[model samples]
Target: MDFYQADPTLENYWRGVILFGRNVASYKFALAHALYEVDKSGSDLVTLEELAVPFSRHLCQHLLHAPKQITSRGSQFLDTCVQFNNGELTQDTLTETTIRLGFNNVIDAFHNVNAGEIEKRFFLDERKTHKGIRITDNFYQLSERQQYQNLAFETNARWNLVEQAWAMGVSRNLVAIEFDEQEKLLFSHVNTRRVNITSCRDSLNGYQKGRCFYCFKPISLVPADTELADVDHFIPWKARDEVANINGVWNLVLSCQCCNRGKAGKSSHLPSRKLLQRLHIRNEYFIQSKLPLHETIVNQTGTQPAQRIDFLESNWARAKNNILFHIWEPKAEGEATF
Candidate 1:
């Protein structure tokens, strides 16, 4: 769609990574959560405080969706934040109380000063002169919060920032350009599992009868050295997540080493229609077992099986909208003839 040539502020403002309404992803959910940090006193202008809210949240909570957290950016940051706290909560696996203690440091990372702006790193350098400006804009040549302006809506004839954050949609081609290499790594790592991917090996193997998720190749339930049962994020973790845990069992699947290697980090990839159907059936099996995962799916979507299917279909709508006819896997490698 030549996203590079399109207007950054207006053209695709309504299209980026939206999380809540229909095609919402966790990344978009992070952005929406940030909009709530704004001050509501009369003025519609955004402040540095508001801008930092989303950045901090993304930096701290991105991997919360994943099954394990040992290697996540938020995990590392949280550990650093609490290295000094002396208590029983630090016994192993931090308690929620320990996590809450670091809340102050997270917010403090975004300084409250005109001199240094940390939030600007995630925004486009280019400015939109027409629609005011965001406090996060450059101190020298400033840009508008135009990227987020479109998300705004009037309540009692006044624009509400929080509401806009919730309703703002995302572009199919949206990319995070502001974060540099080290920071990028902090926000993302596909090989990064929330917990050991192997933890799901037994559960998924039993569910699929020891067949790979995409290829349906026979996998050894007890492969020596765990080579045959490579845990895969059904939706590649690299595609949309900015270093959060995309390793949830809902997204995780057992795959043959070949298929997992071929599908390496293709973030934009979506499963083919056939695979999507397979996934639906597999999930139904999980539900029938009445396991904890079934409850997890319901908690995630707040709906029954019928609505859950609808959500996945809708998520794929944007996922498949890439310029390449099929950015999904098997574009180069031959898919299994299931």
Candidate 2:
């Protein structure tokens, strides 16, 4: 079935794959023990090529269906496996070899069960745009230009201030906005203004509408709850300082705490040629015309206008796919077995 059309139960299966993949280090040690036994019996070398299938099946069955809590050792082994198989882990030690083998097993297993086919199913219809344009293009075009850069920077700075103000409210404390000698706000004071924490949470919640843009998890904020969901910079803030980078609403997204944490400060979005092509944001004129107004509506209302979501989702999905493929290369490396 197409990944998007997969039953929720089947969806959970993929989640299990990701979670298991992340913890492949633990599986590596176990596989190592098995390999040692096989080798000790005067058998041939049990490389990844020899053991991929059974090991993958073993992991899928034991790791996913079993109810036992994963031990720390197991977690480490699985993590190592994923890193090694994806070539992110170096082969300086026996542990690394085992981990790489375990990862190979997982990839083999995923293929055996047609996991890749499922993912392709969901992404099959994802559209492609221009190859030259991207988040940086939009940011530079908007910021370097005479008309909009200052406005963009000022707007982002303002939001930074607003975010701090909202944080104070969550802490149930008063705070003051700190300003430089020139009267420009630098930071917020401790325990000064009675921040409208509810309003701030409401604003972010409304923007996300409860769904994490990346993981698709629901992200709701309870009234008076201190832990607010994070607002992610679709393109990280550190990448540039232009007004377009600061003010573009298309650059913001609602993310669950976990996915947001994973994506923090990551600038390289994807490595695959096809995926990169999809992420390129060509048509500078379109970006210039649309991004500033999108920012204005978001800043004023703390929510995106509906019309913008359609365009933004398409653009964001391409960018997100690029990042996911880069970071989760193991998930993308193997071919579908079926």
Candidate 3:
């Protein structure tokens, strides 16, 4: 489904931008975090300097832990952020640099995803008329959402995952990030040590676009939500002995608790061919996003689309023959919406 057509809600539109949008640099996520921080003041109109404070601060904070924020070889704006983080540059200098170079493309490109603009505009670019952006009613309503904090954490998680991917490089040996199902994180093995990358739930939720993988209902990473999201193995993980790369990102998905473990949960059963096809579509989003998971999926599955499909089907056939005796289907489902 067209991402915006799936749920048209403000929350989904925000997720579409964060999850599916292109990521040549981490500026968009930093800008998104800055928006949330600024929104707390309840100001509809924000000057470039006011927005620059949080925006530069966020990029600086993240840079301290993970150095690579952009996919390119270097960025002058990011270099300025690093200097601020290192105490080599003053906060005033950082703010001025942010205003001059930070908003160059993100301000205009924030709402775009899947080569289209989302239906809702969270902020209006008043920079041409004024010196800043005007927060739209859509943004205020989004700020008031019950899942607002979850959105903030999701952006951080996506940023962390992308940078980690860039730092780890695309080699199979260095970039083999494994999921710790118990801790619900994706971690990589560096030399002899293991480094946890980011929350698996927060990272995958974007590709799923905040909806259940099976029934297509809204889901959340927030601890307080009654119907919390679950990190699920699309093909049952229990049959690992029969399937290669069973725990690969290509096989994992974020599912609603009900569709994951409730009365209609797939449990150890194999999903129907229809759901397998749905899984294929979801995995393609990972490929299209060109994030770290894109390389991981390609290495585990195949380099081409047809080969990836064959990989899933071959494993499904093997698991069907070995472990699962039942074909599980969701009790309730809507049109496929990934």
Candidate 4:
């Protein structure tokens, strides 16, 4: 049977849960319930404080049941989270805690849960000290890693440019292009005449069909889009100066004009590289395995001989891992409020 056939009405329910659970107050309760379900086989045995550690434990356990390819990519994230928890909690080690909880088995514990119905949740304590500091530190570490990667790409591109210059025995004059507040080309050596911002905006809208790449929000009504769809550096420009050219396609992305304005010249608030790697693995597994299973279950149930319980179990395990990585987690406060 296809995974979705087991639970037909899951996608809509999951989307709702994800939307509502992002609220700080609701998130704590939702996370507590998830933790209790994993730990005590019911949602009645755990207190709020006990929920925190087990949430991490459940994440690790679910990861263990994922496909080998996915699990391989998750090693870095697991080690990083363990280290972070160890250092942060100090007295209690994550390794000891995970082992004590008897979650070392690679069993498919989440097979019964509807994969599409699971939503990412978080816990927040208003009175907790160092909360902001921890969140900020995590964001900074990931940002630095992304910046480093961008710089590396820039260096390679600069080297290529130098090679081209040497072969030509002369170089064309470097053009300095500057965009105005409206994203119109205000200054350019190639064309001294000012480029119309409205034209650029219309061009971008046509390209992206008026949708923001990050949040998938419609940008047609956004006032900033009237000037131009903010051309964003996928790999930030500040840290990658070598290839920070005025015309690099790989570095650019279509962003919501509002988000572009707010996030101008700013880095993204991504999770650690370790965490990102894990998320990448989970994402791939979902696309390769679980998504297919969901589609198959929805369309071809009882038509295929290979549709065994074991097959479904494996696929569900893969989906469960994807959910645990929090790949669909909403933005934190003040990040993507457009």
Q: Count the backbone clashes (under 3 Å) in each candidate.
A: 15, 22, 0, 1
Report the candidate with higher TM-score, 1 versus 3: 3
What would the TM-score be for candidate 4 when compared with the true structure? 0.23
- Identify the leading candidate in terms of TM-score: 3
Task: Quantify all predictions' global Cα lDDT against the true fold.
Answer: 0.39, 0.34, 0.83, 0.31
Given candidate 1, what's the lDDT at residue 243? Answer: 21
Worst 10 residues of 4 by lDDT: 18-27
Candidate 4 residue pairs that clash: 2-297
Using all chains and alpha carbons, the TM-scores for the candidates as numbered come to 0.36, 0.25, 0.88, 0.23
Best by the lDDT measure: 3
Give all candidate RMSDs, comma-separated. Answer: 20.9, 21.8, 2.7, 25.7
Per-residue lDDT of 1-338 in model 4, one digit per residue for the tens? 12223222222122223222222111222232343243323332233245446545444443342212121234543563445544664424554453343222211122113333242212223213521101222222323431222222222222222222222222243322233434532222233553221222332232222345454455452343353346664333433433223233212345655555563312342223332232222222222222221122223222333443333333334433443322222233222211
lDDT, candidate 1, at 65: 32
Residue range 167-244, candidate 2, lDDT tens digits: 344234433322221221233344454322112223333222234544445555543333345655554454333223
The candidates, ranked best first by lDDT, are 3, 1, 2, 4
Candidate 4: C-alpha lDDT: 0.31
Name the Cα RMSD for model 1. 20.9
